[model samples]
Target: MKNLIIIGARGFGREVYDLAKQCSGYNTEYIIKGFLDDKSDALDGFENYPEIISSVEEYKIEENDVFVCALGSIKWKIYYTELILSNGAKFMNLIHPSTILNTNAVVGVGLIVFMNSNISNDCIIGDFVTIQGYVGLGHDTRIDKWSHLSAYSFTGGFVVLEEKVLLNTRATILPHVTVRKGATVGASSLVIKNVKEGTTVFGIPAKILNF
Candidate 1:
């Protein structure tokens, strides 16, 4: 059986643990080993979870070991994931059993999709993407690498989320809208037009936020 190691031991790491338990073949095909974090006491207050084994930098990859990243920061997620990749570590996609994924969708490696999320037909989810609970991805949607869709976020058909885009809770993207790379959509915002790269947009119509 393969041993799974979760990267990071913070809030999102704990949540990923809960999701992993509910995934298919929890203990049959693979079992969780422990967390990999620099902070040794990252899981000190947590109960029933395996302690942090070793930091990602120090941990040696075993023959039957696989990894999944649970870090919340997109920048750090990329950094740590790439670091582990350089060490010849393999990653597993942690998809919740309750998630609705269409058969026609194309998904890359290391995707973390939470429960109750719906990915419609013909969608493409890139590597290391995170889709939070209750997020709705419409048909033909394309979400690039390192993009994060927060809880309750919804997108209409043909929406494109470029690399490193962040959609906060309850954000809605209209049909055919393209959120450029490194853009942030605020919570409860409605995106009608294309969001510029590296900008933050908020409000009802989702105008650019300057600060």
Candidate 2:
């Protein structure tokens, strides 16, 4: 089994551990090497099992070891992923067993696909991305690195979600729509056109709001 290290000890990190444990296939394939977190307080309860490993600088990566960033925020996820990669650690994509991916889809490393999510044919999911529960990506869609798709979100065919984009719960993107980097689509919004970078859109039809 390959050694697997998870970054971030709280929040999403804890969720990843739960998911990994629940998914028998992932646990059997990799030995969890504990987590890396700056918050030493978070390590108190988890000291026994999984064996929490501290600093990123202190981590010694072997040839058979792989790392996963369990951070929820897109920026920190990308930052720490790069840090681990620079230290010769390979990133592993964690996909829940309940999720479905088409044969023609391409998913990059370090992605987190939560339970009940679906990636349709010809879709491309980039590295270090987090796709939450019940999200659906239509055929020919492209989701860039560090993007977050919240629960129950839907993206139609040929849609492009740029890096660091956040699609909130139940948001719907029409076919051929483009959501630029760092843009945020609020809950239950409908996206039909291209969204500008670093902007926040809300309500039906997704009107731009001051981010």
Candidate 3:
């Protein structure tokens, strides 16, 4: 079993640590080797495990070490992922044991699928994507790299979320709706139409916001 190191050392990082334990509960495949945070100050604490190690930037990569970028932002996801990859650090997909990934779904590396998230058949989940708990992706959905689906978000079949898109909590995308790159669907918004790149929408039948 490889030793796991979770990057980003914040709330999401700790969450990933707990989720990794859940993955091991059903199948003991990896042993957690504490966390490697970006800030040296973040090494000050952790509710579980003893090792704080060092900031990911200065830490030396080892052959036995595997990483999971627990960063919540797409920009950081790409940045940190590239940082680790360039340094010869390998990443592993951390899918919770309770999550349901269909047989026909295609998931890229460094993906994080939390508990209760369901990826239906024919879906394509890109690299470094974060599917939060209670999220559901219908069949044929395509989630591009560094995108995030927050808890309770639901997407209909054939929906597409481009790179760095954010589907906030409980957001619903109707069938065939495409959320372009870097857009955000506000919490509880109902997206019946396509969302343009870099726009932020909110409310029922989501409308683009000025902010």
TM-score of 1: 0.98
Model 1: per-residue Cα lDDT at residue 32: 95
Q: TM-scores, in order shown?
A: 0.98, 0.93, 0.94
lDDT of 1 by residue, 25-131 (tens): 68998999999999999888779998899999999999999999999899999999999999999999988988988979999999999999999999999999999
lDDT of 3 by residue, 1-211 (tens): 7888888777788788788888843236678887887575664654455466888788898767888999888788888789889989888998987899897999998989899889999999998899999999999999998998999999999999999999999999999999999999999999999999999999998999994
Global lDDT of each candidate: 0.95, 0.86, 0.88
Query: What lDDT score is found at residue 181 in candidate 2?
Result: 91
The local distance difference test score of model 3 is 0.88
Tell me each candidate's RMSD, in Å, in order.
Answer: 0.7, 1.8, 1.6
Stretches off by above 4 angstroms in model 3 are 25-27, 43-46
Quote the lDDT for 131 in model 1.
Answer: 96
Per the 3 Å backbone cut-off, how many clashing residue pairs does candidate 2 have?
0
Please give the distance, in angstroms, between residue 209's alpha carbon in candidate 3 and its true position after superposition. 1.1
Provide the lowest-lDDT 10-residue window in model 2.
43-52
